[model samples]
Target: MCGIVGAVARRDIVPVLVEGLKRLEYRGYDSAGVAVLNGDIKRVRRVGRVAEMEAGVRAENLQGEIGIGHTRWATHGGVTEPNAHPHVSQGLIAVVHNGIIENHEEKRQYLRQLGYQFDSQTDTEVIAHLVHHYYLQNGDLFLAVQQVASELTGAYAIAVMAKDQPGVLACARMGCPLVVGLGEGEQFIASDISAILSVTRRFQFLEDGDVAEVRHDKIHIVDRNRQPVERKLHVSDLSLTSLELGSYSHFMQKEIHEQPKALADTIEPILEEGFSPALFGAAAAEVLPKVEGVLILACGTSYYAGMVARHWIESIAKLPCQIEIASEYRYSETFAKPNWLVVTISQSGETLDTMEALKFAFSLGHDKSLSICNVRESALPRASNLVFYTRAGAEIGVASTKAFTTQLVALFALAATLAKLKGQLSVDQEKQHLDALRLIPGSVQHALNLEPQIKLWAERFYSKHHALFLGRVLHYPIALEGALKLKEISYIHAEAYPAGELKHGPLALVDQDMPIVVIAPNDALLEKLKSNMQEVRARGGELFVFTDLDSHFTESEGVNVIRTPRHAGVLSPIVHAIPVQLLAYHTALQRGTDVDKPRNLAKSVTVE
Candidate 1:
C-alpha cells in the first residue's frame, strides 16, 4: 500500500505534512516525497523512508503553506530517488498518487505526442501531465481534476497542487483511499486517519467520484457534475494515543496483544444495533434478496479471512463461495453471473489487488458488490454496492495481526446477516452465532497469554532456516496464513500445505532442523492433526501445535504442542491466529530484523 497525504493550512504546513508522512511510513517506505506551495512551488523527495525526506527538508528548509506528501510502494519504476512521489509535470502541475493507473501507457503516449516529456518510469507521472493538460483547457483546478478522473479507469486517490491555485489542494478518489481531516485553521488529507490523528480528530470520509478543494479555512465538496455537494463528517472514536505501542518492542507484537480490544472495537458496535450492520429496514431487505452465490475477492490476510468465511457462509447461509485473489480475478476467463453477491475485504481499502478484483467481478456482470474495509474512503468501499467499515482503528504493522482477525469478525457478521435474511437461521441459531462471536475477544485475550512459551519456541527455531505449517479444513487456511506471516516478516522459508497433501511432496523436506507449525485445534481434524504431528516426529522434524488444555498433547521428543482454549469450530480461527503471529514476531526479533519495515516488502501491495 502506498500512503498519500495532503494538507492545506493557514500557517506553514510543511512540518505537519512531513509528520503525517512519518505516521504513514508503515504503509510504504520505498520512496518518499512532498510537493508544497507557498508563494511558489517547492518539492522535497527521496527514495527511502520518511527520515531521509525529513533530513533533506531540515538540511534545505523547504517551506510552504499548503502541501501534499507520499510514501511510495513503487509500481512501474525502480525505487530510485527521482522515481519517488509528488511527480511534477512539465507545466509545473504537481500530484501525489496511490493506486496504479492502468491506462498510463496510452495516456503517456498521447501526452508525448503533444510534446510532453517525463522524468521517471512511473504510471503516476501521467497524472501530473494530465492535470497540466487539463489546466490549459479548464481555468479551474478542481474542474481539471474532475476531467482527469473521468478519463482514468483504474484505481486511484490523487492530490494535486497547482502553482496558480495558492493555499489550496485538490484531491479526488475513484478506487484509491483519501480522507480529509478538519482542524483549527488547518485541514488534513491522508490515506488513513493514522497520519492525521496527531493533527485532527474530525474528518470527512470522502466518497468515490467526490472531489474536494481543501483550503486552510474551508473544504468544498463537488459531485462528478462539478455541482456543490454537502460534506458528511464522521467523528473518529479512535484516540491517536492508543495507536502507540508503548513499551512493546514492535508494533506487530503490540497488535498481537491488542486483538481482544481490537475485536471489541469492531464487533461490539454491531451487537448494540440488534441486527447486523445496524440494519433495520430497506438496507437489510436490499441486501437479503439479491444473492445467487457469494464471491469473496481479496488478497493476502483478507483472502485467509475469506477462506474462514467460506466455512461459515457455507455452514450458515448454505451458499457456495469462490474466493479469488484480486490480482488473478481480472485476467482469468472465469466469471460471476448477474446477481452474484461479491464481498471484498481489505484493511487499507486501497489494496490494489482487492480493488481490481471488485472491478473485475463488476465487469463480469456482478452488479452487487460490497466491501468490508477499515479505511472509509478507500477505493474498495467506493466501488461497492454496499460498504461495511471495520472499526479496527489503525493497524500499523505490515505483518498484519489484528486486521486479519477484525476482517474475520466482519465476514462472520456478513454471513450471519445472510443467514438472517434467508430466514434460515432461527432466533436461537442467531443467538448462538452471536454468542460465539462475543466470546472471541475474550478467547483472543487468553490466547495472547501463551506468548511466553511461544517466545521460548521462537528461540529454538530462530536459527533454523526452514519451517512447515499444516492443518485441514478451516485450520488449513490458518496454517497457510501462519506460514505466510513467518515468511513475509521473518524471511524464513516456510511452506503451508494441507496436512492431507503434506506427504505428497512436503514430507520429503522434513528433517531435524526443520520446524513444523501445525494448526491442531480440538475439532474433527484433531485426530488428523495428531497423526500429522506424529509423522513429523517420525521424520525428526520439530513440531508446534495449537491445541486445547484437555487435549492430550504432551511435549514429545520431536513435538511441542501449545494448548489453546477449546472453542467452537467456527471460533477457532480467531484463537489460532495469535500464536502464529507471536511465533513470527519472536523469530524476526531474534534475527534482529526490522519487524515493521522488512526488506523488499511494503505494507500494502498497491501495484500488481
Candidate 2:
C-alpha cells in the first residue's frame, strides 16, 4: 500500500506534507516524493524512505503553500526515484496516487500516440499525462480530473495539482479510500486520517466514485454522475499521543504491551451488559437469528483470527463454520446460501482482497453480512450491514500485535453472541462466558508480565535458522500466528502444523538445530501434544513450550518451558498471542532487523 497527503493552506505546506508522510510511514513505502506549486511546480523524489525525500527537499529548499506528497509501495515498477510518485506531465501537472489503474496500458498507448513522452515505468504516470491531456482541452482542473476519473478503470485514489492553478487541488476515489480534512481557513486530503491528525480531526470520508475539488477556503464534492453531493463530516477522537512511541523501543513492542487495554476496550462494553445480540448492531436481533452457518472471509492475521473463531463457533455454538482466505475466495466457485452469515475481518478495513471478497459475497445473494474491523470509517465496515468495531486504535507496526488480539476478543464475543442467539447457551452458561470475558484484560496484563521470560527465549531463537511451531485443536491457529510473527519480523524460516500432523510430513524436517515452539495449553489435547513433543525430542529437536501456569510441564534436558497466565477457557487464544508477539519482537531486536517495518512487507495490503 502507498500513502497520499495533500494540503491547501495559507502557510507554507512543505513541512506539513513531509510530516504527514512521516506519520504514514507505518503503512510502508519503498520510495517517496513531494510536489509543490508556488509560481511553478517544484518537486523532490527519492528512492528510499520519506526521510531521504525530506533530506532532498531540504537540500533543494523547496517551498509552497499548495502541495501533494506520496510514499509509494512500488506496484508497477522498480523502487526507483523516477518510479516514485508526484509524477509530473509536461512540467505542468503533478499527481500522487494509490491503487492500480487496470487500463493504464491502453491510456499510455493513447497518450504516446499524442506525442506525450513517458518518464517512469509506473501506471500513475499515465494519470498525470491523461489529466494533462484533458486539462489542455477543458482548461479546468476539476473538469479535467472528472473526465480522467470517468475514463480510468480499477481501484484508485488520486490527488492532482497543476502549476497553472496554484490554489486548486483536485482528488478522486474510485474503490480505494480518500478523506478530506476540514480545517479553519484551510483544507487537507489524505489516504489516512492519521496522516493529517496533527493538523485537523474533522474529516469527510470520500465514498467510491466521488471526486472533490479542494481550495484553501472551501471544498466541493460531486458524485459519479456529476451531481453535487454532501458527505457527513466526522470529528475523530484519536489523540496524537496514541501515535507516539514513547519509551518503547519499537512499535511492535509497544503494541504488544497495548493488548491489555485494546482487549478491554473491545469486550468490556459487551461484558458490562452481559451477552446480547445487539452488541454487534441493532439489526443483529433479526439478522443473526436467520443465520444457518457462517462464512468468514479475511487475510493474513485476520484470517488466523477467523480460524480461532471457527473452533469456538463449532464447539461452543454447535454451528458449521468455514474460513476462506479473502484473496482466494473471489476466484473460487462458491455455493453461496442466503441464510449463511458472511463475516469479514480486517484490521484496516481497506484491505482490498477482503473488500472485493465481501462484494463478491454480496453479488452471490449473501446479504446477511457482518464486518469485524478496527477502523470505524474504513470501507468494509461501511459496506457491511452489521459492524463490530475492535477499538484497537492505530496499529502502526507492519506485523500486527494489538489488532490481532483485539480481533480474537471480537470474534470470541461473536461466537458467544451467536451461541446465545441459537438457543445453545443458557443464562448461567452465558454468565460464565461473560465472567471469563471480563477477566481477559487482567489475564492479558499477566501475559504482558512474561516479556522478560520471552526475551530470554528470544536469545535462543535469534541464532536459529529454522523453527517449527506446534499446537492442537483450539490453539493451532495461535501456533500459525506465532510462526507468522517470528518469520515476519525476525526473518527466521518458521512453519506450523497441528501437533497430530507432525508425524505426517513436518516431523521429517525436525533436527537438533531446529527450535520447536509448542502451544501446550492444558486442554483435552495436552496428552496428545506431549506425545507429539516426544516425537520431536526423539529426533533431538529442542522444545520451547509456552504452556499454562498449571500445565505441570517442567524444564528438563533438551527442553525449556515458559508458563503463561492461567488458561481462561475460550479466551486462551488471546492470552497466548502475547508471548509469541514478544518472542518475535525481541528476536527481531537480536537479529538487528527493522522490527516495525519488515523488508518488503507493507502494513496494509491495498493492492492485489
Candidate 3:
C-alpha cells in the first residue's frame, strides 16, 4: 500500500505536501518523494521517512503552487530514491500512483519500442512515461491522462501534473480509492482523507473508474466511458483531536487504550433502544427471516474477527456459518446459496480483496450483503445491502486494536439480532445479552487494568524469538489474533493452534526458550485448556496464561498468570483481546520497533 497527496493551489504547496505525507506515515512506507511544477517538474526523493525528504526539500528551497507527494511501500522495486514516487519523465510530466499496474511489462516493452527511456524499476515509472508520450501528442494533460488510463489494466489511483499545463492536476482511479477535497480557491487529492484532513473535510469519493481534472477553483470529472458525471460531496466528521497521539507514546498504545470507548460507541445505542433487525439496515427486516446461512468474508485481522463470529452465529443464532479469507475467496470457486447472507468485515472498508470478493459473491447470485466497517463513506458500505458502522474512529496504527475489538462487539450484536429474529432467543435472553453488552466497556476497562502486569510480561517476551499461543473453541480465534499482534509489531515469530492440535504437531516446537501464551477463560473448556497447559509445562515450555480471575490459575516455576476481569460469557473475546494488544505494544516498545507502523505492513490493503 502507498499514500498519495496532490494539490493545485495558489500558495507554495511544498510544506502542505510534506505535511500530508507525514500524516500518512502510519500507512507504512519505505520511501518518500514530492514533485512540483515550476516551469518544469522539480522532484526530490529519499529512501527513508518523510522527514528526510522534507529536509531535502528545505535544503533545496523547493517551492511550487501545484505539486504531488507520495509515501511508497515498495512493490516491483527496491527501497531506493529512484524507486520513490512522484516519478517524472522528460522533465515534463510527474506522476504519483498507488496500487499496481499488472500489464506494466507489456507497456514498458511497447514504450521502449517508441524510444522512451526507463528510469526506476517501478510500475509507476511507466505511467509517467506513458502520460508523457500521450501529452506530447495531445498537448492536453487531462486528455493525456484519460488516454493513458484507458490503456492500462489492473488497480491504480494516479495523480498527474504536466509542466506544459500549469495550475492543473489530473487524477484517475480504477479499483483503488481516491478522494477529491474542495477548498477555497484550491483543490486537493489523496488516497485517504486523513492525509488532507487538516486542510478540508468536504470530499468527493471517486468511483471504480473515474477521471478528474482539478484546477484551483473547479474540478471536472468523467466516468470510464468519458461521459461527464457528478459525485456527491460528503463532509467528514473526523476531528483533528481524534488523530492526535495525546499522552500515548504510540498510536498502537493509544488505540489499545481506546478499546473501551470504541466498544461503547459501537454498541451503546443498540443496547439502549434494544435490538432490532432494522438496526443493520432498512431492508434487514425483510431479509433476515429469509437468510438460511451466513458466509463471512474478510482479510487479515478482520478475517480473524469473522472466524470468531462463526462460533457466535452457529451457537446463538442457530445458523450455519462459514468463514473465508477474502483474497482466497475471490480466486476460488464457491457455491453461493441465494438465501445466505454475505457479510464482509473491514476497518477501512476500502480493502480491495474483500470488495472484489463481495462482488464475486454477488455475481454468483448471492443477493443479500452486509458490511461491518468503520468508515461510513467507504466503498464496501455503499456496495452492501445492509451496513453497520463501527465507530472506532480513525485507527492509524498498522496493527489494528480498537478496530478489532469494536468489530467483535458489532458482530456479537448481529448474532443476537439474528437469533431474536429467528425466534431462537427469548425476550429475557435478549435482555440478558443486552445487559451483558452494556457491561462490555466496563469489562474491557477491567482488562486494561492489567496492563502494568502485561507490561511486565512484555519484558520477558521482547527478547524471545518464537512464541506459541493456544486456545480452545470460542477463544481459538483470540489466540490467532494474539499471535498476529505479536508477529506484526514486535517482529517475533508467533503461531497459534487449537489446544487440541498441540499434540498433533505444534508440541514439537515447544521448549524452554519457546514462550507459550494460553487464553484460559472460565468456560467448560477451561479444564481441557488446563490439561493442554500441563502438556506444555511437561515439555519445559514457559507458559504465559491470560485467564479470568476465577479460572483458578496461579503463577509458579516457568508459569506466569495475568488475570482478566470475570468472564462476561458471550463478550469474553472483546475483554481478552485487550491484554494481548497491550502485551504486543509494550513488547514492541521494549524491542524498539516502530509499533505504530511496523515494517512491510500497511494500515489498509487497497491492492491485491
Candidate 4:
C-alpha cells in the first residue's frame, strides 16, 4: 500500500510530481520523497504528508525536468526521513520502491561484504545498492536494473534514476502495479491511473516482471527475459471530477451516498435483458450446465461480499458453495475440483493475496475461474478466464462503501443466472427477480434517507469503546462489514457474530457501555434475531437496529431503530448495507476521525 510516480518532461516537473503524489494520497502513505537529475541526483524525503514534502521541495528549490517520487506506507523500516524513498546509492543513483523484498537481508549482507554501506534499514535501499553494484560493472542503467531485478526476491515496483541517465527513468514491477503515461514531448509513470490522469490518460499498464524505460519523448517496455513487449495504450474515460469531494465533507461520506448509483450501474447490464448465465461470458452457457459446485476466493471486504454470496448460491441456486479467505487459501492444501466454478472478487483487481490464491487454485485444477472486480485491465481481471466488471468506478476511500454493495449486486446477478441454469427458477420467478433488481437503486435511496436517524443514533457512539454487531444467516456478513467499518474509521473495538453465536462467547462482553448493532431484515430469521437482541438488552446493552418499515421492533429505552423503506426480499443484503455504511460514516464524523483515509490502511492492498 504505497505509491510511486516518475516523469520525464521538457519543462520543470517538480509541480507535476507533487500534484501526482497528492492524487496518490488516497492509496495511503506515511511519508513522501522525490529525486531529480539536474547534472547530479538531488532528492528530498519527508516523514509526513505529501504537503510537507511539497513544502520541502519548494523551500529547497528542488527543480528538475526529470524525476521520480514516492509516497510510502512503512513496511521494512520505521517511518522516518531516512526510511523515506528515493534512497540514493553512493550519491549517484536514486531508487523508489513499492512492495517488499523478501530476501533483502541476504542481499544486504552480500553488498556489505563488497564494501557497500546502507543508510536506511529498508529493503528498497538494497535495490539501490544492488543497482549501483551492477551499474559499476555493466555501465548500462537498463542492464543494471535488469540484473538487480533478477537477483531480488519478492514483490516490488521500482523506479530508478542515475546521474549518468539524465532525462530518463527506468521502472520495473513484479506483484505490484505500474503504468506508463503518454504525452507530447513527455512521458510519465505511476502506480495507478489516478496519479497520472491529470497529465495524460493514454497509458499502458505494465504487467508483472515487465521493465519500462520512460524518456521525455518515448517509452520502451520489456519482459523479464529482456525481450521487447508490445502493450496497448488505453485512454481512460474516468472523469477527473469523480475523484473530487463535492458537497460531501469527506470522500467516505460521498462514497457512502454514491451506493445507489454504483449498484444501479452494476445491475444495468443484467437488467438490459433478463439475467442469464451467458451474461458472464461466452463459456458460461456451457460451464453453468456442468458446474457441480461453487468456490469463492477473496480478501478483506470482498471476502465478506463472498460470504453473502454463499447464502445466495446455496439457498437460491441450490448449489453447494464454499468460501475461502485468499490469504490462507494459498498456504492450505485445499481440495479444488475441476467441476467447481471458482470466483474471485476484488475492488482494485490487484490484491496480492487474492491474485496469488487465484493462481494457486488454477494450479490445483480449478482453472475455470472468474473475477468480479471494479478495475479493468488489472492483474486479477486480466488473469481470469472470465470477468464481471463491477462498474463501481474508482473507490478512493480506504474504508469501502460503494464497492462492497456493488460487488453484492454482481454476485446476486450471478446467483440468479446460476439458479436459472439449474432449473431452480422459472421464467416468472426470473422476471420477478429482475424487477426487484431494477428497484434496488430506489430502495438504496430510501435507505440513505434514514441517515439522519442513523446519525442521531451514532451520537451515542462518540464515547463508545466497544461495539457488537448482530445479524442472522444471510445478514451475518453485513453485520461483519458493519463491525469492520466501525473499527476502521471510528477506532472503536467492534466484533460481529451470527445472532445465534452470541450466547456462546461474545455475549459476556456486552454491558450498558457496549452498543449492539442489529441488522434486522424482515426475513424468516427475524424472530430468532429479535430473541438474540433481547438477550443483549437483558444485560443492559444498548441497541441500534436498522430494520424494515413493517418490522415489529420499535424504538424505546435502551433501543434505537432506523427503519428502512421496505423488505427487499432476496436482495435485502444489498439494501441493508447502505444504512450500515452510513452508520459508520456518521460515527466517524462525530468522533472526528479521518473518515476517508483511515490510519494504517490503504485503499488497495497491492502487497501482501
Question: How accurate locally is residue 601 in candidate 4, as Cα lDDT from 0 to 100?
Answer: 85
Residue 338 shift from truth in candidate 1, angstroms: 6.5
State the local distance difference test value for candidate 2.
0.91
Write candidate 3's Cα lDDT for 1-608 as tens digits: 88999998999998889989988877657999999988778989999899999899999999999999999998888999889988889989999999999999999999999999988999999999999999999899999999999999988999999997888999999887899999999999998899899999999999878999999999999999999999999999899889899998888888888888898898877876677887788998898888999999999999999999999999999999999999999999767886999999999998999999999999899999999999977889989999999999899999999999899988988898889889999999998999898899999999999988998999999999999999888889999999999999999999999999999999999999999999999998998888989999999999999999877877899888988989879788888988888888899999999888898988879889
TM-score of each: 0.91, 0.99, 0.99, 0.98
Candidate 1 lDDT (Cα, 0 to 1): 0.83
The better candidate by TM-score, 2 or 4, is: 2
How far does residue 342 in candidate 3 sit from its true spot (Å)? 0.6
Residue-by-residue lDDT tens digits, candidate 1, 1-608 = 68988888777788888988888888788989988886567888997789999999988888888889999887789999778988888646899998888899999999999999888999899999999998889867888898998888777889998988887789997766688999998899998888888878898887768899888888998877778887678787777766787998778887888889889888886677644545322354676577867888888888999999999888888877788887888789986666768989888887777777777777777888788888766667767778777777777888888889988888888787887777778899878777887888888888888989999988987898989999888888899998998988889988899898877889999988888888887777788777777777888888887887667778867678788877555878888998898889999889888898887777766666
Error of 2 at 467 (Å): 0.8
- Higher-TM-score candidate of 1 and 3: 3
Model 1 compared with the native: what TM-score? 0.91
Better of 2 and 4 by lDDT: 2
lDDT of 3 at 559: 88
Go through the candidates in order and give each one's C-alpha lDDT.
0.83, 0.91, 0.91, 0.89
Residue-by-residue lDDT tens digits, candidate 4, 95-199:
999889999999999999999988898999999999998989988788889888888888889999888878778899999989899999999999999988998
Worst 10 residues of 4 by lDDT: 273-282
Clash pairs, candidate 2, are none
Give lDDT for model 4: 0.89
The residue pairs that clash in candidate 4, if any, are: none
